[model samples]
Target chain A: MKKLINKPEDFVRESLAGMAVAHRDLIKVNYEPTFVYRADAPLQGKVAIISGGGSGHEPMHSGFVGQGMLDAACPGEVFTSPTPDQMLAAAQQVDGGAGILYIIKNYSGDLMNFEMAVELAHLEGIRAVNILVDDDVAVKDSLYTQGRRGVGTTVLAEKICGAAADQGYDLHQLADLCRRVNQNGRSMGMALSSCTVPAKGTPTFALANDEIELGIGIHGEPGRNRISLKSGDEITELLAQTIINDTEYRRTVREWSEVKEKWVDLELLNKPLQKGDRLLAFVNSMGGTPIAELYLVYRKLAEICELEGLQIVRNLIGPYITSLDMQGCSITLLKLDDEMLRLWDAPVKTPSLRWGV
Target chain B: MKKLINKPEDFVRESLAGMAVAHRDLIKVNYEPTFVYRADAPLQGKVAIISGGGSGHEPMHSGFVGQGMLDAACPGEVFTSPTPDQMLAAAQQVDGGAGILYIIKNYSGDLMNFEMAVELAHLEGIRAVNILVDDDVAVKDSLYTQGRRGVGTTVLAEKICGAAADQGYDLHQLADLCRRVNQNGRSMGMALSSCTVPAKGTPTFALANDEIELGIGIHGEPGRNRISLKSGDEITELLAQTIINDTEYRRTVREWSEVKEKWVDLELLNKPLQKGDRLLAFVNSMGGTPIAELYLVYRKLAEICELEGLQIVRNLIGPYITSLDMQGCSITLLKLDDEMLRLWDAPVKTPSLRWGV
Candidate 1:
């Protein structure tokens, strides 16, 4: 394992400075030993959207803070959440009269730090809303932990919610939309190789060349199971089936009639989808999966949907969100209604995710 | 080298199927032996933008198609150009009443196939224009070969030109803009480790743990020289200085009066740049260089720009474009005028590059 760096400790700070200089018009750095927002941000009105996480996922929280998506992003050390103080400063800088929305992923450290920032913001009388994205289906739904971890779905949520916010949807509406995307979407990933964190300077995990870990987390966490490499068609079927089974898309349709019969007053229960409800699918490369391979997965997924008579309204296939450089991909499905489709089609201009102007 | 695939022959076809399934709305496979575009394309009257290249560079041609960027993308096998037939089919399918613009990255196979597609489209009476992107500074300019194989600058050409097309620029104007971006921008790359193309299943080049290859191409092509790995700061300086020296930015400014006198008929030549001109900078990952590392490179670039008194108006940092999984990054700088800045600020909505909506 080889790298180009002066010292491990100087990586994040030096990198941020470089970004500020390179994208002077789009971004600026505060340079006080904290990851702060640039003074110039897009759109002075509406609520400000702020997100931050580890540093390895470039263009994620930081690269995404431009015209359409996040107003400010505080990148922490590689794979480590930013300190609450850093978040507080970002919130202070970007927060206008319209308040702020904190788009947080559900990692333990991320949640805790963002929560502390929210509390601190509240103390300052600056209104804030927190939307925790827990879209990964790899983790089991449990009482002990906070459901599943957030992975690729964060990108979609940020773009969608960013569009809504840019369109003058109040902070509450933006937060609700963010939560809705997180709730409606689910992602499951596998890893053929573990990524080497720059500081560590070696592979994070070792595996035989032929084996792949399924249901892998972004931080190189162990997946649910290890399986031998398979055909693209076979892998697509496995991942798609897992996502469909884990999601409420299929099960909820069947339960719709039963719930309607049990309760007439439940308005939501009566709107049962009678097959052919449209969906938005995303096949994301974890980190190291080639775009070609991701597209291949998308092709097979489309075949499955066609066979099953599901109407895929829209589809996104690429490395929208990623682990460091995990050599695998994840499948994400967002069962869309007409409203979600309209929102999805709305124009967004961010450093990362953008679609439909 | 580890990868997830059953066999090499089935890679491209299987991947195409997966893309169609995952993004059924945005894309659909023709399902004939050849990959074709979805029937519902180019909504109507919107100028079609098409691009294609080798497959390994995921998101290059395919991931970029959507509303604002490419209308259709034809990806070939790993690191191989798509056949002429495929490009012709893609051109026909994506073309609207507004004619088509083919954005060709300056690789031998890419250039040839795209040229053939242009001829085929012309034979069909569909208007077509070609904008060749040749921005890499590593390769010397020559009339015998397409001067300097287009590298990281293709992303800027696609994006800036995409924004122009999205704004309803005529095909000729779009072609000119793409050409201008390619002319104004210059990039040079360095790699730490050679990437393993999925089809090859082996490292493209062998390098010891401490070695680095400079002036590398996106497809794991051999670089100019191999040397001991240096500090990130030193690497950044080496690459940036190389690009700066290769570009005609300062020399053009110095020879502005002479060039203007000689080429008075040319509008662009008549309007030579002054000292206060702004620039757009990009530090792109080869494939595997993390965002953190890329940003570190950007810092050194900023120092150089400051010393040279260059006003960087906008900076894009990250792996917007990439090699398969090459562990390296490249830096790009685009000198900007007011018009270029406005165009850069224009809104774009593509699957890959999106900003200023």
Candidate 2:
């Protein structure tokens, strides 16, 4: 693949420098023996939010750092987590008297690095809270594996929590809200083609042009299954069904517990939803899916939602989170209550995701 | 070429429905009859900004509407501009007492459609100002044809203009600023591979894996020239040099006129740039370029900028505006003055683009 880079190892550092240069007022890069954050940050009282992962997700962690989303984002090497020290610097730079919230995606490396950063922050007398986002429904949970992988849900969590923090929600409230959003949201992705990592200089995995891997991860991780290319409607149905099955299963288990209690006050939990209960559906491109294709997925999703008697109150259909250039997409559904809906309606401004207040 | 769509025609309607359902609080779809704006627009006296174009550029126009960016966005059929009627309705719906600014990309179809909408708005007694974004430097200006086609520059235009509007810049100033940003900025694009428009379900053009087309339009239009794929550094050098050359050429011509009149204000023409004159550089993914590869491009760009004595104040490197899934990127540089930098520093809240308050 033809690329416009110098030494592959210098890509991230040089790119961050250029980003600092281009957005000097909004961002500054700390280039020394290690990458750290500059001193100037946004509102001081507001609890700072920090998130990072592999550098390949450009707008994910970095693009989101600004007034309303993240206070700082530490990007590691391409598709690799930042070192613990980097996260510690990010935490120190953004941490105010209030505190800092670490929004860690459920990748093993990211989790470990962020966890270590939290420890470092504690050592520095900074109060740091960790919120792990594990919203992907593609993976099965077992004692043996690392639970479901966090995918598109991280964006939603960051935006929602960012708004909460902006609204002066306490650190506990912000952490709780982040956890709730992650719990309520579910995502599943598919890949039509393998994305070539820059260093690898080739496709991460080989797939015939006609074949697709369902439930793929952002790092080109193998999905649960492989299948022939399906129609847009079929693809939506396949993904929606998987998500619905997972979510419904969880709901059913929760409801069964309520039923066993036989408490009359459980009416709110047991009350059947009316036609207008809100839902936020995100039809996200996994890098290579076109807007046209994404909208097609939205169309099928609408049909499925209508048939299933689910009221989709809010829908975002685009490439919010991506998987390099994997050529497929994921569907994320966030069931919303009145409060969550209001938060979703609140205005936000960030580099990549924006809406409401 | 298996797709998830039922039929090509149903894509837009279905997607709109899904969007309304997913983001009910933020957006609504007047499906079947027309593409109308949601009644829940946030600002009251703010002049509504409406923009749209072909649907393949997923988040370009529609994904931008909310909070600080756009009031309404009309989505056209794949790779085709929306009709005047759709834009007119969007204009009317977003018009909050104040006039409306139509941020139109400089495509023949988009320009014509938006122009018709402006006339329609005038007929309806609605004040409408049109700002044409013609920042692409690839297309040579000639009396025989329309000027350069708008490419990635539209994103920055919408953003800066959006911030201006959000901060209560009058409609005239907003429109003027939009034009100023467009005038000050230039973008040139290249594509390593032609993207597959979902409706077409085939690559727009075929090229060997090692080949690239320079000056490619966002909608899979033929580029100014094609070239063999080279190293990332070479590609960055080619693109950055083109942009720098254009800027320098314009500077020289202006200087020549000043010298001839003996009214040469070198300070005004060649403003003494400080060590930290803010510059915003965007290494935009045409569509399919991976974030890793995009960063590689940014790295080389930083090196070149340092060599050229340009202080990049800020940088955005990602797929902000895209060309479906074309595997390439474009670079945009906006030299920022003190006032411009302050405006850039001002906080903004939008759906797709966000920065300082």
Which model scores highest in TM-score? 1
Question: Taking the tens digit of each residue's C-alpha lDDT, what string does model 1 give over B37-140?
Answer: 53468557767877778776755766666655667777778888887787777767777778888878878788777777777777787777766677777775
lDDT of 2 by residue, B1-357 (tens): 544466667766665665554455445655432563545663678888888888767567766666667788888887889888887787767788788888888777887787778777878977787777777777765334565777777877776776677778877778668766776777888888887766787888988877888888888788788888877788889888888777321221111111142212221122222344457888888767666567667777888888887777666676678876778899988766565666665665444455442
DockQ of each: 0.43, 0.34
| lDDT value, residue B199 of candidate 2 | 73
Q: If you superpose only chain B onto the true chain B, what TM-score does each candidate give?
A: 0.87, 0.87
Candidate 2, residue A188: lDDT? 90
The docking category that best describes candidate 1 is acceptable
| Estimated TM-score for each candidate | 0.80, 0.77
Candidate 2 on A264-332: residue-level lDDT in tens?
A: 211111122335546788888876666656776887788887777777777676666776667888998
Tell me the lDDT of candidate 2. Answer: 0.71
For A1-357, candidate 1 gives per-residue lDDT tens digits of: 666567887877877776676556556676453664534653566789988888776667776776567788878888999878888887888887688898888788997888788777877877776777777777764345555787877877877777787788887678668767777777788887888887888988887887888888888888788888777778778877777766332211001112132211211111222257577878877666666666667777787877777777887766556667667888877777666777678865444555544
